[model samples]
Target: MSTVLTHVTDELQSIFDRARSVAVLTGAGISAESGVPTFRGGGDSEIWTWRGRPVTELSSAELIATDPQLVWEWFDYRRGMLTSVEPNAGHRALAEWERRFEDFTLVTQNIDDLHRAAGSLNVLELHGNIWRARCLRCASTFEARESPLEENPPRCLACNGPARPDVVLFGELLPDGVFERAEEAAARADLFFVIGTSAVVYPAAGLPITAKRRGARIIEVNPEMTDISFIADVTLLGKAGELLPQFLKERG
Candidate 1:
């Protein structure tokens, strides 16, 4: 192993040995390795660029309310994409860590269900899940195992009203309870691992900083430098699939 990897391995082992409570934050980078497309960069834009809009634009509240069919079409495409992909090694490593740790929280920004599919529990999806839907009228929620509604936009069985993906669309507030739980986890973490994310998105981006302020040691694992890299206690420069397993092996 290179000198940097050796240093990271030693640091990670130290953290794992000492930490009683841990919090992990993941982003599109983790899912991208599993065949899920990311929202930025060349490859990402090529796949999603046909829409001629940013991800935020496609998921805006105005778009969902004014042109529901268009939104559904976009969601349908994403759903199909997610169905074809599977969880990667990085996901499995995190899930394994969850089983080993007495107190751990896996916070993910990706809407893909790969984290859950990899057998991770105590996951907090900061964005939302693609497999869930909620009524626009009554807010009744349901899990769509096989796309329960046939209508383009779908409708709630209870109120027979329009239903949208349960994700946090642009301009829409995050689910109240979920944000609170994520904040609590961040605040209480003794060791915080930021994986695959650039730490650019608001509120969610503040999580690592929050944990840092509370005296949590922040470790960043990514191939590229992120906004939080300077503040991180250790910056492990590598793909998460490669680095996480190494760190876990050291822990074992």
Candidate 2:
């Protein structure tokens, strides 16, 4: 069962009141609430398999190069699964925060575009979006949202070369300059919200500590204790969808 949230204390309210600049980092946990299967799998922690191989193995630059068709097929199926998924309350709350704060940044580890769907304009996707594809030959990139794309391993619009999902694979580095932007935002924020992530994945995980070290207050929102929970200035334990809306309501 999800943990029940206690009362929103005066100290907690003060933290929100004192913040002028805010930055938020989100992960698969937030998207999972909207039915997106997480990288570590969802509620059951079952690894998604494709042709007897874990999907994680298939999600690599090497695999995409060796068998582009197989990679495309798997991603196409994944896209179809997310076609009807909608942004939930947690997503909307962040979007509202963006409008409320003059300097707000939303950095996410998810490839899902739910943050943008929820009307957050200042999102920096650390992982490239799943709905976008990159050209193999010319290295051009574009959005290709057609579920079960007309052509498996869809052709690049700029070049006839085959396309691959524009995501940061197991061994691939983050998209160019994305991490730097997130770092700058974290450093500049007066309040940093680490939501729905365990903060175990490095690089992305290190962002919270960066903000904390820079003298920003760190607020962690998750259902269970995480690796970085000890460092959080305020740790709100509950479902993000349930807690975030309540948080905004209390702040108002």
Q: Which stretches of candidate 2 lie over 4 Å from their true place?
A: 1-7, 250-252
For residues 111-134, write the lDDT of model 1, one tens digit per residue: 888999999977898888888888
What C-alpha lDDT does candidate 1 achieve relative to the native structure? 0.81
- Which residue segments of model 1 deviate by more than 4 Å? 1-8, 41-48, 51-54, 147-149, 250-252
Query: For model 2, which pairs clash?
Result: none
Q: Which RMSD values do the candidates have, in order?
A: 2.9, 2.7
**TM-score, per-candidate, Cα-based:** 0.91, 0.93
Score candidate 2 by lDDT: 0.85
What is the alpha-carbon RMSD of candidate 1 to the true structure? 2.9
